[model samples]
Target: MDEIDDSQNPGFPPPSPTKENWRNQYYAYRSPSGEIHYLLLSDFYGHLVKTSEDVIGSRFIKKKLQTATIEDKNEAFKELKPHALALMKDKFGSRVIKSFFEHGLDLQRKGLAEELFGNVYTLSLDQYGCRVIQKALELVDMDQKIKIVRELDNHVNTCLYDDKASHVIRKCVECVPEEHIGVIVSVCVDQIVKLAQHTPGNYILQSILKYCKNTLTQKRVIDGIVSSLVILANNGFGNYVVQCAVEHGKPEDRSKIVEKLAENIVEVSLNRFGSGAIQKCLVFGSHCDRKLILNVILGSTDRNEPLQTIVKGQSGKFVVRTLLKTCDDEQRELILLRIKIHCLEKYLPQED
Candidate 1:
């Protein structure tokens, strides 16, 4: 072909090499606000991909996605689907993924779940990804939730102590459906005592006790804990596990715990942390169990010495107050009589 004057060709224009002209290729003006907004040039999803890389940018995109119309969200989901796993492990991107599950449409959630399904265990073990997995576990449907839990099935015990994974396990225990609750509990039940004593595992144990709904499962877990009552009740973190058992365990289970505490009522009541466990027993324990606790505080020799000692200390006084509220009329009068004999009324304020 003859060398046509290239500038005269209307079909094509020579490329502009100036930086400003290149920059203009990727930015556009908004008519309503008369503001220039950044645009994605090379990559169709470039803007989202860019925002996902920074903390503030990711948060802003999350808010935008939250309020975005269905069509817009669906479009965004298509862009994010391929990189969902990678984003899940990103600090800022993880948050955006979590927000998507929290506020995205069902189809969007399902698309995200597919991205997360087989890799649940790996994500659950990641510091950032674990949070995203937990969020998915909490909000996804039963089938998908089970798939997530199943990934952690054989590894439940290990995850229970992992700093990051433990939180995911706790969420699984607390929010997984009733059918799957047993799956998680069974894996950890045999390790209850060990888990209860661990700083992080203790929390996992508490979640299991607080949320596991099966009667037999609750009893089994409580029995495991009851066997180690004193040790757990004395631990700073484990104490909360013991307290959770008291609050959520069956009456028989609570009674067993109360009886356990009653065996060393004075020592337990004297402890700063154990005192709270004792108070829970009194709060949730059965009629006979409460009586047993009261009798312990009343002192074995009828000297009212134990009662006086508890009422004198700050933490112990709370146990004393719990007793006063739960005790029967006759028992209340007996406790008050002991308080008067010991002159312990100063520890408690007089009624108006």
Candidate 2:
């Protein structure tokens, strides 16, 4: 057991259980007579925690949890259940805990979850602890799932932006039913613009769009970004949310976004990121929505001024190109003629 400190050995995989030095390594131990003996899975009674903290030992325990008999697993669980939370935070012990959830029986998982009851929030945010919480969310029953996700009530704001914790919140949104995860909806409770403009928060909003399939639920999420349509459209990171909204949102929602961008079609089409929103609206919006955007760009259709301005600008040029690609033949002819005439006038400057 003293040799469990792995710093002393630099060998690639350490010694295998089948190797000659197995009895002399970390799993090697002493008998009641004070003589050394080989430690087997059956002998994993009192030493589960210590050996689990070792890299090799934890790997061995996880394998046993996977394929070992119920009695062999229960033997390790007897000693492990008490230390569940602490080991959840352990570097190596956490993986062992995850493996247990993966293969442990229901009663055993319930027992393990009880040990994790009040600590779900802390564990959800913890580096190693988060892994265990995610595993439980994926594997635990709904009643238990609600309990674990509910612990994240007020902590979601911090969790939403956190590198590690955000995944837990995302997992809850993903796996938990729409009715039970009001806590996730509450992160965007205000449904404000900043939520869409926020870089990290975009992921949550995107998940809400993709997974929260209920009408009112999806509406709440779509409205949140639509409310900030113009702001998000012009933004760097926020534009992704807008594009996602157009792709996933209802037709009316797409119309709403196109209408908003049409308010300043030329400028929006000229913006670095806002142009994407316009192109997305073209790709996904109704025919009326496409023409609504096109007319805005085709400002003063009788003249070539609007066509020239949009075609001249670098960003707006792409919007026009995308429009040509996505628009129908009738609309393409009208726009293409102006473009043809404009190129002739610019290149055929023989008024010298």
Encode model 1's per-residue lDDT on 85-195: one tens digit a residue. 999999888998998999899988888998987888888889899999889888888788878887888887778888999898888877777687666678778888788
State candidate 1's TM-score: 0.83
**RMSD, every candidate, angstroms:** 8.4, 7.0
Each model's lDDT: 0.78, 0.78
Query: Can you write out model 2's per-residue Cα lDDT over 1-352, one digit (the tens) per residue?
Result: 3423334444323344433344333355444344554555676666788868877788778766777788888888888888888899999999999999999988888888887889988887799998898898899888998998778887888887777887888788888998888767866646547766666677777777777778887777677776767788889878988898889888887788788889878778778899888889899989999898788777765665656776676677778888887899999997777778667334221222
Q: Please, what's the RMSD in Å of model 1?
A: 8.4
| Model 2 TM-score relative to the real fold | 0.77
Error of 1 at 92 (Å): 0.8
Once superposed on the true structure, which residue ranges of model 2 sit more than 4 Å away at CA?
1-47, 55-64, 213-217, 302-314, 344-352
User: What TM-score, computed on C-alpha atoms, does each candidate reach?
Assistant: 0.83, 0.77
